[model samples]
Target chain A: MKQACSIPARAGIGLKPSHYRDALDSVGTIAWFEVHAENYMGAGGAPHVWLERLRSNFPFSLHGVGLSLGGAEALDQEHLANLRTLIDRYEPGLVSEHLAWCRRDGLFFNDLLPLPLNEESLDVVARHVEQTQEALGRRILVENPSSYFAFESSTLEEPEFLSELCERSGCGLLLDINNVYVSACNNDFDAETYLGKIKAEQVGEIHLAGHAVEHLEDGETLRIDDHGSHVCDAVWGLFEKFAGRCTGVPVLVEWDTNVPSLSVMLEEASKADRILTQVSSH
Target chain B: MQNGDGDTLGKIVGDDSKFSRRFSVYRNNVYHSLTVALSDAYPVVKRLVGDDFFLAMARTYLDGGGFPVHAPLYDFGKDFPDFITGFAPAESLPWLGDVGRIERAWLQAYHGADAESGGMNLEALSSGDAERISGLRLVFHPSLCIEQLSWGAFEVWEARGGEGVAGMKVEARKNFIVAARGMDGDVRVGSFGEGVFDFFERLHNGKGIMAAAGDMDVSVVGEVLGGLVRLGAVIGVEE
Candidate 1:
């Protein structure tokens, strides 16, 4: 997996350990494979061995979820060094982080957490992104996280914040359509409006995933970004509209939890490929 | 921010109260992810306790100040096995801590670095170079870990999905379990006699060859050393 290992601007599915054998049996199928950087941080194990075997077949996208890019504290140098090693070794087509904080005061949450979209937090996030890009010596992509809460202190909308961060830090955007849909539905906004704000050129990639619907006791339903099922029709509809915006950006189907059979994931990727084919000419 | 719930989110980020209702979702995400990681790490412990009990226990572990100290959550529960010793609900199960200890050792060995450190390490020692060997320290494989259990809890672990460790004898179980990474990168677990366990434990504690060998039984030392070499658990002699 190197910069020359191209990911055809098609749809790919996350290469989970459970699907590794099946994925190998069917090569030249997916556009690329994406894995969480933290999952590979171990010094050596079966994960690395399996990943090494798969790397020869597909380009990779190292998506990091635990960098705590939006934290108030300084960027973790040790983690950055490990990430640099990964980038140097894999030479992934694209590397990405999130617009969220998961660690505070040396405590790790291990989940994508929201941040206050204010000037202070934005400054913190931009500095971290710059530091990361400098450390990796590559242009990295920052993802839009699904939010379950909003802060009064958040002055900038997520799209504006991400846009400015790109301008300031020379990074790219990974516009996740599923996140926009889940966040919009959760926060009382329109998903299309969220995606409409993102310019196509800024987006280096697109993420589409499934989320769970949790019904509240107060008779209100909230969408949780669980990534444990098929991409709902609503999210698929939004991805269709969003695809025309980014003509060649690689789209990924992520199913992290309750991962079904490999065939099911391939079906989702096929659905995305069909959609991408339908919209590519536009 | 402190409570990490919707109300705390509102106080820090939101001026309006309308978003407070959405806090449970994020809260569930955080706790659910943390518990899932813990559950993955300590599956046997979760199985020992049912899912609901384990989930509640994991939530308590989080709420009672058990946050991960690193970026990646791989080493999140470094102290969890130790934490289980004092937990009240599991107090009735005396062998629980020992099982936890063995599982933790297995995980550590599995995640440890790649080491082709094995060699014909003990070959020269057979020639009776006593003085030279005394000053020489042995290099153990990077993934090697030796744990002495209160009982042979490996039986329980092997039977995790089956009859479980119910009514297993603690008295007859003088267990010394060792975990090491095989050449093929899988973690392998084995149990050794007391003499072999002591020899490795002494070496792990940086004891000199003479000091460790003095405590070793005469007959088993040959068998144990040969077995360790065969297992590729021993690295070269360190000077």
Candidate 2:
């Protein structure tokens, strides 16, 4: 069995197949790595082979994209079982899922669909989170999803919903700074105010990614969480400010679409590491 | 909301046109991500049909209630090949569906279970009594897949790695293709003759050496079995 290791309070890159060779070569250069759990759920293949090779070199985290923890229906038991199997096999330092639903009535939409932040919906998500933690036998961090629009039925603010979820389910928070920036922009809220509402102690990890800006016909601007390019200037400012509060939280630089070279990804990681270093030294 | 039940959820977002545009973002994201997953799974098919046609066909497939029923998009789109077979727009290129099948088989084999540690024990084959050897059942690797397609899908699939389908003709000939992960952990797609394909198919279905051989020439069966051994497809011999 592999030895138990914790994700250090440092910056890491989301591991992609294109950079497996370079990642293996520059293990110590990057603090750690995170992977979408569904990508590695296959029985056996190159994914598992490279993950095994890389796991030995760097601490790893399993970030899930399909759990649909906030869905209205019962959780998919088979997916939970597959996740358990992967957790046992890989033994990642941290495991997480989104604060949004991807499936409903047995049809998976493949996108993180926003959920209404009301008491009833809150009950459903809290129960699901507890059930997932119980089933996996590990406490998981729930991420705040980026939304294009808000539901009027929502009775609570985004941070309030996440705070109540952590309190009720006993789970940690994966404060995605870019998502905060994106949501704040779209919903016409202050990003720093939203950040202030989050209980920093419950934040186990931080995520930084890029978003695409679109100009609407009626002079409205929309930011889509595409994670395709470099971390923008505003998001970096948010991370730089938030880094001081969450001193040792492991930060991940996520680039899922239009993935660049390993050196580029490492440069992104180094950027976060520099802020983290300055904050911790103070 | 996910089921598109009504405007109750939609109204909650907002009643304004700008809000409707924002709501469409979720719809667009769902469609875009699922389409990307299908494209990844059926690259050769996409390459053959070109992006515009492929996107149209994929949108049609999704619009007709063909969305994935579960998570981990890797397991999604298993029926895309079959969906292409009956798709109206793709009828002109009948061979395209078979190429999709070959690509899907290649992906399945790539993600299938790892083979057992050892390869075929040649010593056991040589040392065992003739009767015992003839009655022994072969255990093939989990990743081995044999497709007896009605089109030259193998050529088209191979072309994706070469000059592509620019000036090539896709003949409607019977193609016996095998997709399996080799010992080096790379999934290889190869074409074979009818006799070899049939022999392996029989062995795959739990037939012993003599039973799988059927009425074929003994020499031909020996040569085919040697090829299977070399491919590392035969993992063990079961009594």
| DockQ, all candidates in order | 0.61, 0.74
Instruction: Give the alpha carbon lDDT tens digit for every residue of A96-158 in model 1.
Output: 999988777778877787878978888899999999988998888999999876677789998
Can you write out model 2's per-residue Cα lDDT over B1-239, one digit (the tens) per residue? 44444364545565677666887888888888889999999988887788999999999888887799879776688888888999988998888888888888899889989976745555566564767778878877788877777787677788882466767787878767777787678787777676477677788899999998878887787777666766666777777
Candidate 2 yields a Cα-based lDDT of 0.86
Residue B184: error of model 1 in Å? 1.9
lDDT of 2 at A231: 94
After aligning candidate 2 to the native by TM-score, how far in Å is the CA of A149 from where it should be? 0.5
Residue A95's lDDT within candidate 2 is 93
- The number of the candidate with the highest TM-score is 2
lDDT of each residue in A7-110, candidate 2, tens digit only: 99889999899999988899679789999999998888899999999999999899999999988889999999999999999999999999998887789988
TM-score of chain A of 2: 0.97
Candidate 1 has a DockQ of 0.61
Candidate 1 lDDT score relative to the true structure: 0.79
